[model samples]
Target: MPKKVVAETERRRRRPTRQGTVLSEKLIVQTALRMLREHGSAGLTARRLGAALGADPSTLYRYFAGLDGLTRAIGEELMGRALDSWTPTGTWRADLRSLGLAIHASYLAHPQAALLTASRVTGRPREIEVDETILGILRDAGFDDIDAVGTYHAFIDLALAFAALDAGALAINDDVREADEDMWTSTYAHLPPETHPHITATAHLLADRMNHSAYPAVLDTLLNSAEARLAGREG
Candidate 1:
């Protein structure tokens, strides 16, 4: 065996597919992601995954213990992609904002996967690294342990919550998604001023703004609230 193949074999137990194609964890996760994108959440099954990979369904057990384990692995892959190219700039608030956007974008890229795993706690390597990075940023910015933990919890949960919400919207089929988008302009904007004065008065503004994700604004608010709390502690 080539040294590379030997290393892979040592790193993970492998089995050749029915076509004699070798399999690894990375390949499986990537295949699973593609399946999710092509078929939506319902399309990802061990048997289907096996057929896609040209491997026996039983072969998957050696890699992921079960479907739940595989789901977490997929979630970890998203986390890995989010942080892969990002480097902190030492400004805690700005760094956090960047991180939040990156995470949200990654989840949005695979909305079905995000819908499945956004709120999950994988405890996998990439997920652990992300958690540590957030906590480290807060600690470096002078948050005490308690405040750091609390703020980190709030920050991550808020980001994932928005990711789930936005991804769910995106995951809807095209016609429904378009209709939902159009509702802001068609339905909300055209409400009669006499019966619904408030909505009618601001209908134009609401139509203009209602189509975008509120994650950025919500993230800013959370960061600003944390900053206020930290400043109060110092004074």
Candidate 2:
């Protein structure tokens, strides 16, 4: 069947279930995200999703092509949320910083979803919009095409990479996460200064800071580099 025909047919089939739950792509994605948060990535199977929605597992195919397609939708939803929260200021440095933090915080807020979707390249609407917005910000700030593209690429990759990295830390079981966090204070902070002089010297700082996500600091560094490049170009 033609893709559009299939989509139309699917739309026609949308209806309320016995529980009065209306089935739609948005509902499914939202339900899936909730499941992921409560049960982690491994728990978002079709059967479980259908059970949560009070629908047949097969009914999901009407809205999404398959599990992969549904997963992409989930990814796009997160991106859409991040984009929605941001209002760009004309100041490139502040705008990029705000955007970067919003994206990072959005992912961190849903660590389970971030673990599954942060590394994905959905190439969907929100993802495309974010790319365009970043490029526009850089270009408007006097970056040439090459510079804008390069900066966009780096900025996005850094944001997502840090999201995935931090989400991994957050998505671990509570007990495991506590153990990991405790290790900074218990193990690293108590290492022998004779052999681990550098670590011992800064153990207090490390104990204070290591448990936190480094995304904010790293973001500032990247933005600084981009600003320097732009300044050099104008000079």
Candidate 3:
């Protein structure tokens, strides 16, 4: 290629650089989300992000206070996006299930980001909406204010716990149920023939019970307990 052609190609490839003017806070946060999706949490840093954006590393300060601030922003962005896309039908169980699964699926969609963001409580506008909606559902289902909020708290806690646990399991490259099965097998597969009487004798059945999904039975049990508890209570 000629010198003129080479120069033009380089110019086209160059990044925008107006120092403080070119990099907006919104742009930084937005780019961070995209980076999180592509590179995972550990890959995101101010210096690396600046290079990707073609701005000076120090210029990022105009947008975010630092790395921690950027992480929180990304968390809030993800939650906001998830909740904005949600619309509640009138069915209480259906709505609750939708909310729990939506959040879990969205988080698991980006495993690294999920692990980082799952533990945080942003208390942002979207979070407030979620809380209010949950409490309202419980109240409409015959719970009083205290009971409603208590149920809402339990629901939120369970969703967060499940999401966090799922993320952690995936982070270690383990299938959630499979990991539990392995634990049961490694610990129980070789019980002693003499010393431990009760457990050693039951080893065969224990092996049979291991490696299965306990969610169905456990959830059924929980549902029964909830029904019994609610049955005797006044709304």
User: What does candidate 3's lDDT look like per residue over 1-235, in tens digits?
Assistant: 1122122233332345654335555677777777876777887987889877777676565545577666776667666666776778986666766776666666666667777887887665666777777778767877677766766666666666666666666665347657676765677757676877777788777778744433334434444555565666953
| TM per prediction | 0.93, 0.94, 0.66
lDDT against the true structure, each candidate: 0.88, 0.88, 0.65
Ranked candidates (TM-score, high to low): 2, 1, 3
Instruction: Give, for candidate 3, the lowest lDDT window spanning 10 residues.
Output: 1-10
Residue 30 C-alpha lDDT in model 3:
75
RMSD, candidate 2, Å: 2.0
TM-score for candidate 3, please give it. Answer: 0.66
Please list the residue runs of candidate 3 whose C-alpha ends up more than 4 Å from where it truly belongs after superposition: 1-27, 37-40, 173-229
Off by over 4 Å in 1: 1-20
lDDT of 2 by residue, 163-189 (tens): 999999888888999999999889998
